[model samples]
Target: MPRTPRTFTVSDSIVVAASPEAVYGQVSRPALTGRWSPENLGATVHGTGGADRETYVGMVFDGHNKRGPARWSTRCTVTAADAGERFAFRVHAIGLRTPRLRGPIA
Candidate 1:
Protein backbone atom coordinates (compact mmCIF):
# COMPACT_ATOMS: atom_id res chain seq x y z
CA MET A 1 0.00 0.00 0.00
CA PRO A 2 1.09 3.52 -0.61
CA ARG A 3 2.59 5.29 2.44
CA THR A 4 0.08 7.32 4.37
CA PRO A 5 0.32 10.99 3.73
CA ARG A 6 2.11 12.88 6.45
CA THR A 7 -0.25 15.40 8.02
CA PHE A 8 2.00 16.71 10.73
CA THR A 9 4.39 19.58 10.21
CA VAL A 10 7.48 20.53 12.15
CA SER A 11 5.32 23.22 13.83
CA ASP A 12 2.68 20.73 14.87
CA SER A 13 2.73 18.65 18.04
CA ILE A 14 0.61 16.85 20.56
CA VAL A 15 1.44 17.15 24.23
CA VAL A 16 0.28 14.18 26.26
CA ALA A 17 -0.19 15.67 29.67
CA ALA A 18 -2.63 17.42 31.96
CA SER A 19 -2.82 21.05 32.92
CA PRO A 20 -1.13 22.77 30.01
CA GLU A 21 -1.59 26.08 31.77
CA ALA A 22 0.36 24.92 34.79
CA VAL A 23 3.11 23.60 32.59
CA TYR A 24 3.18 26.86 30.70
CA GLY A 25 3.66 28.83 33.91
CA GLN A 26 6.64 26.76 34.90
CA VAL A 27 8.28 26.92 31.50
CA SER A 28 7.34 30.45 30.49
CA ARG A 29 9.93 32.09 32.66
CA PRO A 30 13.46 32.05 31.37
CA ALA A 31 14.97 31.25 34.74
CA LEU A 32 12.52 28.46 35.21
CA THR A 33 13.22 27.19 31.72
CA GLY A 34 16.93 27.19 32.49
CA ARG A 35 16.34 25.17 35.62
CA TRP A 36 14.29 22.65 33.72
CA SER A 37 16.53 22.44 30.63
CA PRO A 38 19.99 20.98 31.18
CA GLU A 39 21.28 22.29 27.87
CA ASN A 40 20.63 25.80 29.06
CA LEU A 41 23.50 26.63 31.36
CA GLY A 42 21.90 29.92 32.41
CA ALA A 43 19.03 32.25 31.50
CA THR A 44 18.31 35.79 32.49
CA VAL A 45 15.15 37.80 32.00
CA HIS A 46 15.44 41.41 31.02
CA GLY A 47 12.88 44.26 30.75
CA THR A 48 10.17 44.75 33.34
CA GLY A 49 7.19 42.84 34.65
CA GLY A 50 4.70 41.61 32.07
CA ALA A 51 7.03 42.80 29.33
CA ASP A 52 10.36 41.01 29.53
CA ARG A 53 12.96 39.53 27.22
CA GLU A 54 14.92 36.40 27.94
CA THR A 55 18.63 36.35 27.26
CA TYR A 56 20.18 32.94 27.23
CA VAL A 57 23.80 31.89 27.42
CA GLY A 58 24.87 28.43 26.44
CA MET A 59 27.17 26.37 24.27
CA VAL A 60 26.78 27.26 20.59
CA PHE A 61 28.60 27.02 17.30
CA ASP A 62 29.79 29.41 14.65
CA GLY A 63 31.01 28.73 11.12
CA HIS A 64 34.00 30.65 9.82
CA ASN A 65 34.99 31.54 6.29
CA LYS A 66 35.16 29.00 3.49
CA ARG A 67 37.22 25.90 4.29
CA GLY A 68 37.19 26.96 7.94
CA PRO A 69 36.18 24.51 10.58
CA ALA A 70 33.22 25.19 12.85
CA ARG A 71 33.96 26.87 16.14
CA TRP A 72 32.13 26.59 19.43
CA SER A 73 31.20 29.71 21.34
CA THR A 74 28.74 30.97 23.89
CA ARG A 75 25.38 31.59 22.27
CA CYS A 76 23.26 34.60 23.07
CA THR A 77 19.63 35.71 22.81
CA VAL A 78 17.80 34.09 19.95
CA THR A 79 14.27 35.27 20.63
CA ALA A 80 12.31 37.67 22.78
CA ALA A 81 9.03 36.36 24.01
CA ASP A 82 6.15 38.39 25.34
CA ALA A 83 3.85 37.32 28.14
CA GLY A 84 1.31 34.95 26.63
CA GLU A 85 0.15 31.38 26.24
CA ARG A 86 2.52 30.90 23.30
CA PHE A 87 6.13 31.90 23.55
CA ALA A 88 9.16 31.59 21.28
CA PHE A 89 12.91 31.50 21.78
CA ARG A 90 15.97 30.86 19.67
CA VAL A 91 19.28 29.08 20.18
CA HIS A 92 22.26 29.77 17.96
CA ALA A 93 25.05 27.45 16.86
CA ILE A 94 22.91 24.45 17.72
CA GLY A 95 21.04 25.00 14.48
CA LEU A 96 17.79 24.45 16.31
CA ARG A 97 15.07 26.36 18.09
CA THR A 98 11.88 25.78 20.11
CA PRO A 99 8.48 27.23 20.93
CA ARG A 100 6.69 27.09 24.29
CA LEU A 101 2.93 26.72 24.34
CA ARG A 102 0.16 26.60 26.87
CA GLY A 103 -3.50 25.48 27.06
CA PRO A 104 -4.14 22.39 25.00
CA ILE A 105 -1.36 21.05 22.81
CA ALA A 106 -1.94 21.63 19.15
Candidate 2:
Protein backbone atom coordinates (compact mmCIF):
# COMPACT_ATOMS: atom_id res chain seq x y z
CA MET A 1 0.00 0.00 0.00
CA PRO A 2 1.17 3.53 -0.74
CA ARG A 3 1.62 5.89 2.20
CA THR A 4 -0.23 9.18 2.35
CA PRO A 5 1.49 12.35 3.46
CA ARG A 6 0.53 13.74 6.83
CA THR A 7 -0.02 17.34 7.85
CA PHE A 8 -0.37 18.92 11.25
CA THR A 9 -1.03 22.39 12.57
CA VAL A 10 -0.47 23.77 16.03
CA SER A 11 -1.52 27.12 17.44
CA ASP A 12 -1.19 28.79 20.79
CA SER A 13 -1.77 32.21 22.28
CA ILE A 14 -1.65 33.94 25.65
CA VAL A 15 -2.89 37.23 27.00
CA VAL A 16 -0.23 39.30 28.73
CA ALA A 17 -1.19 42.14 31.01
CA ALA A 18 1.42 44.56 29.76
CA SER A 19 2.26 46.96 26.98
CA PRO A 20 2.98 45.59 23.53
CA GLU A 21 6.56 46.70 23.74
CA ALA A 22 7.02 44.91 27.04
CA VAL A 23 5.46 41.76 25.68
CA TYR A 24 7.53 41.92 22.54
CA GLY A 25 10.67 42.31 24.60
CA GLN A 26 9.99 38.98 26.25
CA VAL A 27 8.70 37.03 23.26
CA SER A 28 11.30 38.21 20.79
CA ARG A 29 14.12 37.07 23.02
CA PRO A 30 14.84 33.51 21.92
CA ALA A 31 16.89 32.84 25.04
CA LEU A 32 13.82 33.10 27.23
CA THR A 33 11.52 30.83 25.23
CA GLY A 34 13.07 27.69 26.71
CA ARG A 35 11.68 28.63 30.08
CA TRP A 36 8.12 28.64 28.84
CA SER A 37 8.04 26.10 26.04
CA PRO A 38 8.57 22.43 26.71
CA GLU A 39 9.64 21.59 23.17
CA ASN A 40 11.95 24.53 22.46
CA LEU A 41 15.14 24.11 24.44
CA GLY A 42 16.73 27.39 23.27
CA ALA A 43 18.43 29.04 20.32
CA THR A 44 21.90 30.27 19.42
CA VAL A 45 22.53 33.23 17.20
CA HIS A 46 24.70 32.49 14.18
CA GLY A 47 27.47 34.59 12.58
CA THR A 48 29.70 37.02 14.39
CA GLY A 49 29.53 40.57 15.79
CA GLY A 50 25.72 40.56 15.89
CA ALA A 51 24.62 40.55 19.47
CA ASP A 52 22.12 37.89 20.51
CA ARG A 53 19.75 40.59 21.74
CA GLU A 54 19.75 42.32 18.41
CA THR A 55 17.43 40.87 15.79
CA TYR A 56 16.94 42.11 12.26
CA VAL A 57 15.79 40.90 8.90
CA GLY A 58 18.10 38.21 7.50
CA MET A 59 19.57 37.37 10.85
CA VAL A 60 20.23 33.64 11.23
CA PHE A 61 19.96 31.42 14.25
CA ASP A 62 19.75 27.78 15.25
CA GLY A 63 16.89 26.48 17.35
CA HIS A 64 17.14 23.44 19.57
CA ASN A 65 14.03 21.39 20.16
CA LYS A 66 13.18 18.20 22.01
CA ARG A 67 10.26 15.80 21.88
CA GLY A 68 10.61 13.24 24.64
CA PRO A 69 13.88 11.43 23.93
CA ALA A 70 14.21 12.85 20.46
CA ARG A 71 16.23 16.02 19.96
CA TRP A 72 16.91 18.02 16.82
CA SER A 73 18.06 21.40 15.58
CA THR A 74 16.54 23.68 13.00
CA ARG A 75 18.07 26.61 11.14
CA CYS A 76 16.05 29.80 11.31
CA THR A 77 16.24 33.14 9.64
CA VAL A 78 14.48 36.28 10.66
CA THR A 79 11.91 37.42 8.13
CA ALA A 80 10.20 40.17 10.11
CA ALA A 81 11.17 42.08 13.20
CA ASP A 82 8.88 44.95 14.02
CA ALA A 83 9.24 46.18 17.55
CA GLY A 84 6.06 46.01 19.64
CA GLU A 85 4.06 44.74 16.66
CA ARG A 86 5.39 41.62 14.98
CA PHE A 87 8.41 39.36 14.88
CA ALA A 88 8.70 36.28 12.74
CA PHE A 89 11.32 33.76 11.70
CA ARG A 90 11.40 30.96 9.18
CA VAL A 91 12.59 27.52 10.26
CA HIS A 92 14.30 24.93 8.05
CA ALA A 93 14.82 21.32 9.03
CA ILE A 94 16.78 20.21 6.01
CA GLY A 95 19.59 17.64 6.46
CA LEU A 96 18.38 16.83 9.95
CA ARG A 97 18.07 13.30 11.26
CA THR A 98 14.63 13.67 12.74
CA PRO A 99 12.98 10.57 14.10
CA ARG A 100 9.59 9.43 12.91
CA LEU A 101 7.31 8.59 15.77
CA ARG A 102 4.34 6.34 15.28
CA GLY A 103 0.91 7.25 16.56
CA PRO A 104 -0.57 5.70 19.67
CA ILE A 105 -1.18 2.01 19.41
CA ALA A 106 -4.78 0.88 19.36
Candidate 3:
Protein backbone atom coordinates (compact mmCIF):
# COMPACT_ATOMS: atom_id res chain seq x y z
CA MET A 1 0.00 0.00 0.00
CA PRO A 2 1.02 3.61 -0.49
CA ARG A 3 0.35 6.68 1.64
CA THR A 4 -1.82 9.35 0.15
CA PRO A 5 -2.40 12.90 1.28
CA ARG A 6 -5.76 13.52 2.90
CA THR A 7 -7.61 16.67 3.70
CA PHE A 8 -8.98 17.18 7.16
CA THR A 9 -10.45 20.36 8.54
CA VAL A 10 -11.95 20.97 11.91
CA SER A 11 -13.64 24.24 12.64
CA ASP A 12 -16.39 25.61 14.84
CA SER A 13 -17.50 28.99 16.01
CA ILE A 14 -19.41 30.37 18.93
CA VAL A 15 -20.49 33.88 19.81
CA VAL A 16 -18.19 35.58 22.26
CA ALA A 17 -18.46 38.76 24.27
CA ALA A 18 -14.85 39.73 23.64
CA SER A 19 -13.38 41.39 20.60
CA PRO A 20 -11.96 39.42 17.71
CA GLU A 21 -8.43 40.29 18.74
CA ALA A 22 -8.98 38.81 22.15
CA VAL A 23 -10.45 35.65 20.68
CA TYR A 24 -7.69 35.33 18.11
CA GLY A 25 -5.10 35.94 20.82
CA GLN A 26 -6.37 32.92 22.74
CA VAL A 27 -6.81 30.51 19.83
CA SER A 28 -3.65 31.54 17.93
CA ARG A 29 -1.39 29.95 20.51
CA PRO A 30 -0.76 26.31 19.66
CA ALA A 31 0.03 25.64 23.33
CA LEU A 32 -3.45 26.66 24.45
CA THR A 33 -5.43 24.54 21.99
CA GLY A 34 -5.87 21.76 24.53
CA ARG A 35 -8.41 23.84 26.37
CA TRP A 36 -10.90 24.07 23.54
CA SER A 37 -9.95 21.07 21.41
CA PRO A 38 -10.82 17.52 22.35
CA GLU A 39 -7.94 15.62 20.71
CA ASN A 40 -5.24 18.25 20.82
CA LEU A 41 -2.83 18.06 23.73
CA GLY A 42 -1.24 21.33 22.75
CA ALA A 43 2.06 21.36 20.86
CA THR A 44 5.84 21.37 21.11
CA VAL A 45 7.56 24.01 19.07
CA HIS A 46 10.48 22.76 16.96
CA GLY A 47 12.96 25.64 17.48
CA THR A 48 14.25 28.14 20.00
CA GLY A 49 11.51 30.70 19.50
CA GLY A 50 9.01 28.24 20.89
CA ALA A 51 5.21 28.44 20.57
CA ASP A 52 5.21 31.82 22.28
CA ARG A 53 6.52 33.56 19.18
CA GLU A 54 4.24 35.76 17.11
CA THR A 55 1.80 33.98 14.79
CA TYR A 56 2.59 34.23 11.11
CA VAL A 57 2.27 32.26 7.90
CA GLY A 58 4.89 29.47 7.62
CA MET A 59 5.38 29.20 11.39
CA VAL A 60 5.95 25.57 12.25
CA PHE A 61 4.94 23.55 15.32
CA ASP A 62 4.51 19.96 16.41
CA GLY A 63 0.93 19.14 17.34
CA HIS A 64 0.53 16.68 20.17
CA ASN A 65 -2.72 14.75 19.91
CA LYS A 66 -4.45 11.81 21.60
CA ARG A 67 -7.51 9.62 21.35
CA GLY A 68 -8.39 7.51 24.40
CA PRO A 69 -4.91 6.00 25.00
CA ALA A 70 -3.49 6.34 21.51
CA ARG A 71 -1.07 9.22 21.10
CA TRP A 72 0.47 10.85 18.04
CA SER A 73 2.23 13.97 16.84
CA THR A 74 1.94 15.96 13.67
CA ARG A 75 4.16 18.55 12.03
CA CYS A 76 2.12 21.61 11.12
CA THR A 77 2.84 24.83 9.31
CA VAL A 78 0.74 27.91 9.72
CA THR A 79 -0.93 28.55 6.39
CA ALA A 80 -3.07 31.51 7.30
CA ALA A 81 -2.67 34.36 9.76
CA ASP A 82 -4.87 37.39 9.97
CA ALA A 83 -4.71 38.98 13.38
CA GLY A 84 -8.17 39.38 14.92
CA GLU A 85 -9.60 37.47 12.00
CA ARG A 86 -8.29 34.02 11.22
CA PHE A 87 -5.57 31.48 11.96
CA ALA A 88 -5.03 28.12 10.32
CA PHE A 89 -2.43 25.42 9.77
CA ARG A 90 -1.93 22.30 7.72
CA VAL A 91 -0.67 18.99 9.04
CA HIS A 92 2.20 18.00 6.78
CA ALA A 93 3.42 14.93 8.65
CA ILE A 94 2.52 12.51 11.42
CA GLY A 95 4.06 9.80 13.63
CA LEU A 96 3.83 7.97 16.92
CA ARG A 97 6.38 10.08 18.80
CA THR A 98 7.42 12.56 16.13
CA PRO A 99 6.31 13.52 12.66
CA ARG A 100 8.20 10.85 10.66
CA LEU A 101 5.52 10.22 8.02
CA ARG A 102 6.19 13.15 5.78
CA GLY A 103 3.14 14.21 3.71
CA PRO A 104 -0.21 15.77 4.28
CA ILE A 105 -2.44 14.04 6.84
CA ALA A 106 -4.72 16.95 7.54
Candidate 4:
Protein backbone atom coordinates (compact mmCIF):
# COMPACT_ATOMS: atom_id res chain seq x y z
CA MET A 1 0.00 0.00 0.00
CA PRO A 2 1.06 3.54 -0.76
CA ARG A 3 0.21 6.63 1.24
CA THR A 4 -1.19 9.61 -0.68
CA PRO A 5 0.71 12.87 -0.44
CA ARG A 6 -1.27 15.50 1.39
CA THR A 7 -0.58 19.19 1.84
CA PHE A 8 -2.22 21.75 4.11
CA THR A 9 -1.59 25.38 4.98
CA VAL A 10 -2.61 27.35 8.07
CA SER A 11 -1.67 30.66 9.71
CA ASP A 12 -2.57 32.51 12.92
CA SER A 13 -1.52 35.51 15.00
CA ILE A 14 -1.93 36.64 18.60
CA VAL A 15 -1.45 39.92 20.44
CA VAL A 16 0.12 39.70 23.86
CA ALA A 17 -0.07 42.56 26.33
CA ALA A 18 3.66 42.52 27.08
CA SER A 19 7.04 43.41 25.65
CA PRO A 20 8.52 41.50 22.72
CA GLU A 21 11.15 40.03 25.05
CA ALA A 22 8.45 38.86 27.40
CA VAL A 23 6.58 37.28 24.52
CA TYR A 24 9.75 35.60 23.31
CA GLY A 25 10.47 34.29 26.79
CA GLN A 26 6.98 32.86 27.03
CA VAL A 27 7.37 31.16 23.68
CA SER A 28 10.67 29.62 24.74
CA ARG A 29 9.48 28.76 28.22
CA PRO A 30 8.51 25.10 28.49
CA ALA A 31 5.87 25.50 31.18
CA LEU A 32 4.18 28.43 29.46
CA THR A 33 3.88 26.57 26.15
CA GLY A 34 0.94 24.54 27.45
CA ARG A 35 -0.94 27.72 28.36
CA TRP A 36 -0.99 28.62 24.67
CA SER A 37 -2.27 25.19 23.64
CA PRO A 38 -4.32 22.84 25.78
CA GLU A 39 -2.98 19.83 23.93
CA ASN A 40 0.52 20.74 25.08
CA LEU A 41 1.41 19.39 28.49
CA GLY A 42 4.92 20.83 28.64
CA ALA A 43 8.27 20.99 26.88
CA THR A 44 11.85 19.89 27.56
CA VAL A 45 14.94 21.56 26.12
CA HIS A 46 17.73 19.31 24.93
CA GLY A 47 20.48 21.84 24.06
CA THR A 48 21.58 25.44 24.53
CA GLY A 49 21.78 28.87 22.82
CA GLY A 50 19.29 30.53 20.40
CA ALA A 51 21.52 31.02 17.32
CA ASP A 52 22.37 27.32 17.03
CA ARG A 53 18.90 26.46 18.33
CA GLU A 54 17.77 23.50 20.44
CA THR A 55 15.19 20.75 20.56
CA TYR A 56 11.81 21.25 22.21
CA VAL A 57 10.09 18.11 23.40
CA GLY A 58 6.42 18.69 24.10
CA MET A 59 4.08 16.31 25.86
CA VAL A 60 0.30 15.94 25.57
CA PHE A 61 -1.80 15.25 28.61
CA ASP A 62 -4.65 12.84 28.42
CA GLY A 63 -8.00 14.06 29.64
CA HIS A 64 -10.53 11.61 31.01
CA ASN A 65 -13.11 12.01 28.31
CA LYS A 66 -13.94 8.83 26.40
CA ARG A 67 -10.32 7.81 26.65
CA GLY A 68 -8.18 7.56 29.78
CA PRO A 69 -4.99 9.43 30.62
CA ALA A 70 -3.10 9.04 27.39
CA ARG A 71 0.32 10.66 27.14
CA TRP A 72 1.79 11.59 23.77
CA SER A 73 5.07 13.20 22.75
CA THR A 74 5.90 15.59 19.93
CA ARG A 75 9.08 17.32 18.77
CA CYS A 76 9.34 20.88 17.46
CA THR A 77 12.19 22.54 15.62
CA VAL A 78 12.95 26.16 16.44
CA THR A 79 13.36 27.17 12.81
CA ALA A 80 13.26 30.95 13.05
CA ALA A 81 13.96 33.51 15.71
CA ASP A 82 14.82 37.18 16.15
CA ALA A 83 15.72 37.69 19.80
CA GLY A 84 12.62 39.47 21.21
CA GLU A 85 10.84 39.94 17.93
CA ARG A 86 9.68 36.79 16.13
CA PHE A 87 9.96 33.02 16.40
CA ALA A 88 8.72 29.98 14.49
CA PHE A 89 8.72 26.21 14.82
CA ARG A 90 7.75 23.12 12.84
CA VAL A 91 5.67 20.43 14.60
CA HIS A 92 6.52 16.90 13.52
CA ALA A 93 3.86 14.23 13.70
CA ILE A 94 2.71 11.78 11.09
CA GLY A 95 3.35 14.50 8.52
CA LEU A 96 5.72 17.48 8.44
CA ARG A 97 3.35 20.38 9.21
CA THR A 98 4.85 23.77 9.91
CA PRO A 99 2.62 25.28 12.57
CA ARG A 100 3.54 28.93 12.28
CA LEU A 101 1.95 30.04 15.52
CA ARG A 102 3.16 33.60 16.12
CA GLY A 103 2.01 36.70 18.01
CA PRO A 104 3.18 40.09 19.30
CA ILE A 105 3.79 41.03 22.89
CA ALA A 106 1.86 43.80 24.53
- The most accurate candidate by lDDT is 3
Error of 1 at 45 (Å): 1.1
Best by TM-score: 3
Instruction: Write the residue-wise lDDT of candidate 2 on 24-76 in tens digits.
Output: 77768776678778898777777775445577888876677788997776767
* Tens digits of per-residue lDDT for model 3, 1-106: 9998665677877789999999999889998898889999998876678878888888889999999999999999999989999999989899999899998587
Per-candidate local distance difference test:
0.39, 0.69, 0.89, 0.48
Ranking under lDDT, best-scoring first?
3, 2, 4, 1
* Candidate 3 local lDDT, residue 74: 94
Model 2 residue 68 CA deviation (Å) reads 1.0
| Model 1 error, position 60 (Å) | 18
Alpha-carbon shift of residue 55 in model 3 (angstroms): 1.0
Alpha carbon deviation, residue 93, candidate 4 (Å)? 4.2
Question: TM-score order of candidates, best first?
Answer: 3, 2, 4, 1
Measured with C-alpha atoms, the lDDT of residue 100 in candidate 4 is: 31
Model 4 pairs in collision: 16-106, 17-106, 18-106
Per-residue C-alpha lDDT of model 1 across residues 11-103, encoded as one tens digit per residue? 656674757656656655555544655445334334444214332232122211111343222223424333335544443332222222222
The candidate, 3 or 4, that scores higher on TM-score is 3
- In model 1, the runs with Cα more than 4 Å from the true position are 1-14, 49-85, 91-106
Poorly placed runs, candidate 3 (over 4 Å): 1-10
